[model samples]
Target: MYIRSAAAVSPQASFEALFTGAAGYQGEQLSCIEPDYTSYIDPKLIRRMSRIIKMGTAAAVESLKAAGLEQPEAIITGTAYGCLADTDAFLSRLVEFKEELLSPTAFIQSTHNTVAGQIALLLKCHRHNNTFVHKGFSFESALLEARTMMGENEITTALVGGVDEIIPASHALLRRFGLYRANGDSLRLVNEPAKGTMAGEGAAFFVVDTQQSANSLARLDALQTWYKPSTPNRVADGINALLAEQGIEWKDIDLIVAGRNGDTGDDALYDLFKKDIPETSFKQYCGEYPTATAFGLWLASHILHEQRVPGVEGLKPRRILLYNHYQQTHHAAYLLSAC
Candidate 1:
């Protein structure tokens, strides 16, 4: 039900082979430049894994190792674009090689479930293994499922994660569809801007279990995701619902971690609320990736454990509420109370 050990590989120089540290992004670009695969993956295994599979697998391994577990009862993942690099590579081969002598290596690894499958294979976990690919909510969806598993006692240990990779042709396609900007310029949220949100990519994995994990960093108070927001008042109402459910109050919290990615007008929902709760800004570090929210979650977990707010990461947060509004149509919120 709670994230005990969370690890990630993000564009911000967070390279743990499985976990990465806070590295800054310089441009409109956000990417996970992976750690050395040779170090974490077997050479024989390295040749076959697509980047998504590698990212998820490496994170899972490190997270479990950090939690001092051999394997989880279930492995679940969320991905906006699964094995995108491999899919693009296969498509290129399909055209360049005339689909004549195309290798199945890339194509075989190109599915949404490949990452989950590979983790299961490596861990030899034959229990619950599943994947969800739902645009931006992919990772959160996986996390929600793991929460259910924990509550039901169907599984005690669950490895849940989100992984996404950038693909050139897909970026071009997104640009054409107006999901991206024209000049490849960095986009930040304004009260009102001209265009849309920026594109970002990363992988975040968490070791979750029913047992009281000694490595537990944060205790999850609530997790919420919804579509169709009518007003800032509605969001406030949602926050109230969470607070009421958890017997928490607005001023009882120490920090707030917000995903205000500087979307044209999309982040307004959070902007209006921060005025009331008043925590720190997390998006400035991770940028506007869909799962960038994961960093906020991971940071909150770390903050709870350290019993001290991390420098800039905690500059404004004490109760650490992971909050975000995406695509102008989706809003997600998570509340983490210090343990």
Candidate 2:
């Protein structure tokens, strides 16, 4: 499939800003630099939507506009933690009110599929709408389903996205479990390895079609995912198998965008696999999240489309490989070509 267009609501202001020099943070979490919603969403409705919903909707709208599409044939979303703020509010109200005469707004939008459903409602689309909530593999599962539907001739175009948010309650609970570093630096996350990585959250969406178009950003050649393997060598074997199937070797790949989240234990695999390859870490720009691979894919697509690497001047690549693993469990690789 070809990526017609891509958009993201992330911590960085823009793609150029992210590549040139991202803004540094001193806190343990990175929040998205949201865009103005007046253009994408109704002024009156914006107040009702949560942060995650607004982010996801705006991104999806921007992506569709870039693709010159008004309505997609399918809508799919992947989220690890969906509408966390709303969920927290609903649960708190349930306890405070003794489960009597509680407002249903928060409860209504607290489901894992709320973002996707909201998008569909906004567009008046009744096509195949689905959301996957498989922790780290959520985004991959959504993409895989889109690819399958396209292959089966069920849809010509689709809007697929991965979204997650960071709330105070979720952050505090996760910090208690030693997930984030206190007052960690986000800019130098990958270079200066440490015990924990900073928290991150964002929403990224893509418009994909089976046939290439004038606005095609890149050709998605291959995608593969692996679960917890018995040994590290199995990962290497899987990489080889994927490359062999694509009829390309490691030397043929011009660039590699890896997931190195500054955590020593988490970044070890990325370090071992990226040896001698023209590689760069993306987590430094976006911090660490469950579906971070979505941001990595977004970066890769833009790099191929622009024919330029952000910081690496005078070096252009034709093919890019994206490799990321969520907590060393859900591993995924994507091969993209500048076609």
Q: Top lDDT: which candidate number?
A: 2
RMSD (Cα, Å) of model 2: 1.0
Cand. 2 TM to true fold:
0.98
Candidate 2 deviant stretches above 4 angstroms = none
Over 225-277, each residue of candidate 2 has an lDDT whose tens digit, in order, gives 98997876688789889999999998999998988899999888876676577
Per-candidate Cα lDDT values, in order, are: 0.71, 0.89
Over the stretch 1-339, how does candidate 1's per-residue lDDT look in tens digits?
666888776665542211234454444556676788776678898789877778777877877877887878899988877888888888889999887778788888988899889888888899999988776677778888989887887888888888877777777776675665443333233222445555777777888877666677667767888767777678779888987898878777666766766555565566577545545555555556556666667767776676555343434344667777666666778887655
Give residue 49's error in model 2 in angstroms: 0.6
TM-score of each: 0.88, 0.98
Best by TM-score: 2
Output the lDDT of residue 242, model 1.
Answer: 89
